[model samples]
Target chain A: MGDIEITELRKLTEFIKQEFDYDFKNYAMSSFRRRIQRVLDLYKMDSVDELIRLLAKQEFFFEEFISEVTVNVTEMFRDPTFWRVLREHIIPNILLNHNKISIWHAGCSSGEEIISMMIMLDEMGVADKAKIVATDVDKAIIERAKKATYPLKNMEVNRKNYLRYQGKYTLERYYKESGSEAIINPSLLENVSYRKHDLVQGSVFSKFDLVLCRNVMIYFNQTLQNDVLHKLHESLFKYGYLVIGSKESLIWCDIAHKFIVVNNEEKIYKKIKD
Target chain B: MPKFELSTKYKAIVIGGSAGSFQPITQILAALPKEFPVPLFLCLHRLKHVRHGFVEALSIKSNKDVIEPADKESIRKDKVYLAPANYHMALELGHFISLSTEELINNSRPSIDITFESAAYAYRDKVIGILLSGANKDGAAGMEAIHAKNGMTIVQDPSKSVINAMPNAALARTKVDYILSVEEIIEFLLELDKKYRI
Candidate 1:
């Protein structure tokens, strides 16, 4: 086909799944097209067929392609209001119910979600009683997340968000500046376990008391969104909480009846069914 | 019952505005028929951190329901879908809403360019794009994108806008199909609605 990118999207995705063993067939067509366009522009390829030919020839390029495919533009305390609610109400309830809380940062990009959680828990003096799992499909991103270092330009928004969350100390107190980079405190990740699990194909590794899969589902089509919701539902214990993106919801998903809304605006839900 | 004799019907009407277009937008929504045939997608600049009141305010004057669509939400005709704050909303291939937090384009999260370009991409010539008043040049390239795809482009009259930068920017680069004042724009939209086939 002449314009395979738009017309034969399914063919490209199927080829990728069969060749690379990653399931991108279920990704939302718009965002997938955008990301694929980025990859094409970067490599100066003519079309999806040309890109596929190169991918088949160079096995070493998949890792690099994975980085470009996944969007990693996340921030610490991206939504301060959501963080405040989680810190003030949700975590306290979980703490009251159990001595320890297990949190799964599903689709955690570059460790900001994990770091933000640690800071929130630290502020509440409950850091010791928490276990966190951070996962992404890309191992390279996971490695960068583990390092917890971010460039200074990214910090402007991060710092602004943290202040809005009403932290006890300045965000700068947590990271030291070094040549245009801010190195986050590694101690924040002491209880966090990072994994390179694909949300699309990887099995549910374990259940959690709380699962945060914010903004990740935006890239998936409705069919895959429903499938992932069921998977996430199974990965939560009864009465456990699920927090999604501000715009995405558990309300409109297949498992809507299984969960009760805890905070609608923040998109936090409590799983009531097993 | 096709209203117009066009070979292909327009699928969507995407309007982008920044600062001063809200009044015109309010008038447009308040004046459209309850069951307008074409879908209306609006991308307006609003506060990123504050998301509670904008939709409510828009809904107050709107004859039809004004919604801040969720990610992956279905696109239906007549309903006014506003790009929710802090997310870039795109019109997908199958008339679905695609929301993303990709890096800000033109210093806006709900960037007008993204939504307008998406409309042009999905609908091609079956799209109508409108650019309204603002201080920034965000929607200029979007109107250009629509023009490139053979989709119709409309710009608010620069002299009638609250601020002229946005519409004037579009006028400067592209040959827009219409440059109408607020009253004429409302009249034109009503005419389009009448001519649209459900």
Candidate 2:
């Protein structure tokens, strides 16, 4: 694992933004450098300059860069305690507020959260009450999310997480296992729309009752995080709910005053002001 | 071993351990005074799903606040920053903590390598890295990184560790500054605290 100096990193990031039109300029510097090293190792390159030159010469290799940088790793029902809270507390309150609810799954990689939310809605007998808009910056992952088919090896982790979440039924009941893939019941996708919307550059598509941008902003610097948070705020209705990643918070951001902490431990906040 | 003054000013301390390390970590934290000037980082391997109680358990024995830092939190003095479960916590330039869910390195999410390399890259020779007992080779590369950056490196004496694999693996990787038993490790910390005061 070779290291990328700060100046080399800035050069590569600037090159990508100017040539490829993908803005990694505002990413968290330390992690961004490490991810670039992964690309370098993958291509057997020795320096950042080589990576930049190859990316410039080869047009399609840009996708490889996107895949490396935005790795979008997710598991079903991650942080089971948060799911328990969402099931027992947050959902019921959101149900009381609107007869029909809308949820924006910002950075919804592989649609696990949407699937988890659908299961929760079905168990709570509110499947018909919500519409889900799941978006990722990568269209390829958006396709993967819509298919909702996962490797069979990953099901064990998902099943354990679902059990910890205390689901009403075993997770196996929701998906049929083929030889190597577990294809989730496609009916769950009926109420969900999948799109490729870049959170960093794209405008708000709709107002959601609950906007879930979980664990996605850790890749961004503080400036980009506040920018994304504001976008999430604008995408939500007044007095609506905002759920960030468990380790992420709103207290330190510029918009902290507009939202009140609904559950500090769970990282749930309610918008008190638009 | 030339002491290298044993009193050089240090910016940060990163300690990583796994199996059979909890008691020694507790003793080290318990022995350090509340006004400890340098920021301490602990990246112990633990269960991924159970996120709540580890810090609280450690805080019970220590006077300093034992916190699992939020992503991008400012590195501050007088705090025991425990790496949270399931997230790889790394140090950044300008003294910030960065967390990521990058693919598991050496079958560990909080790979000891990630934290140690980041701290070494950010602070270079000003950081002190310590590796302790564990069941795997996760911290070996980390110890090497610290050594390459000229940071002070310490590992628990492998013979004294309940599981010798971790410390022995690190010793196999690089030349360490110290190989101390758990008791000596605690004393070294207390003495290091006095150096910070000077």
Candidate 3:
């Protein structure tokens, strides 16, 4: 926790950025320090230079380290009220304006949430009309999401949350239990695709009707948040919905004005037409 | 069909803290009924990136529902939504909980302020926002917003709080409607449920 450590870590991070083409330039200082300390602890190396030297030799080490640092904390039906807002407000808007919808569940940690979205659409009778592009920075989570199984301990809340989202049928019906894991219904993922996407790089595609980039922006600094929001703004269709984590606000982002708050409380935004 | 009506269906209790919040929170929650109809949202900030079974542990301490909030899930009447570590928990309209990793206010995700502020905005007069013992000013602005929205607000009396900075800071910012011990907060909630039920 010293200035010397901070300086060394910054230099090392910059070195990685230049050589690896992966940017750690914009993460918060505290988080960066914590991750560096963990890396040091993991390798039993005393200095940042040593860790960086090892990382230079092992390319896979860098990938694994990034995954360790950026692993997300998420669950199915995360913000019940946010989902309700989507269902009551955003879903209707999508149904009315967009004939077909493509949603990007950006930073979809383990795909449970993307499955949740599909379930909601199924309940709304719009499952066939929607296609989701689920992306995450971590390969492990993507693999897990692809498998679509979660501990049964988490089911009660997930089911309760489904009810709270106002699903008409029992949430229990969607999944079959395999040992302790609840294997998600394959039908829910029929129209979805999962890939690796880092928000810092910005996205190549556009014209998405809804882009759900929740809880992922907190990893970035304000400048990065703005950058990511701008990317989201450009990618969304006119009148498309942009949903962020509940605590996130576009007020400070550079493109804040481009979207109107659909439900300010839920942090739901609707892209305003030019 | 005299439907449940006091203000809105989003009626519920929300509790928040940073450090040293787990026990007081469990104590307060354990006193509630098995079928407590109001949803309970808890924002207990802990060590970063650690999911240490806080919800499982606390659920054992209380009969009412408890679990981590999932993306796009709905808020239930009696369940407790514990902020997953490293994320901010907020109330979206229509009683769903939204989790975020947005810029950390007061340097914490699952921030007490963000959770209380969003609940206040969505639930208005129907919310009961409580700030428990902690080490920072995270929940102060949020509790203030809740009060301004005509929601009921409560804080553990700092004198009795294990970590007094959070409750003390909240009391300094807003005229909290109740400044009680953890036990009293539970009593107040139970009383309100009975008095206001349709």
lDDT for B62 (candidate 2): 97
Best by TM-score: 2
What is the per-residue lDDT of model 1 for residues A1-274, given as tens digits with 9 covering 90 to 100?
1223555677787888999899888888777887887788899887888888988999999999999988888889988999999998999999997999999999998989899999999989999999999999999999999999999889998999999999999999899999999999888789999999999898989999999999999888888988999999999999999999999965567778999999988999999998
- Residue-level lDDT of model 3, residues B1-198, one tens digit each, is 522223334386789876777788888878888777788888888864345577778988798878876644567786888888767677765567655554466978778877887777677777888889899999998889888888887888888889999999988888888788887777776766676565
* Per-residue lDDT value at A72 in model 1: 86
Clash count, predicted structure 2: 0
Question: lDDT value for candidate 2?
Answer: 0.89
Per residue, candidate 3 scores C-alpha lDDT tens digits across A56-116 of: 8888897778766674556667777778878887888788866788898888987868988
Q: Pick out the ten consecutive residues of candidate 1 chain B with the lowest summed lDDT.
A: B1-10
Off by over 4 Å in 1: A1-4, B1-8, B196-198
Residue B29's lDDT in candidate 3 = 74
Model 3, position A3: C-alpha lDDT score: 20
Off by over 4 Å in 3: A1-4, A39-46, B1-198
- What DockQ does every candidate get? 0.78, 0.80, 0.08
Q: Is the docking of candidate 2 incorrect, acceptable, medium or high quality?
A: medium
Interface RMSD of each: 0.9, 0.9, 9.7
Off by over 4 Å in 2: B1-5
| TM-score of chain B in each prediction | 0.94, 0.96, 0.91
lDDT of 1 at A104: 98
User: What's the TM for chain B in candidate 1?
Assistant: 0.94
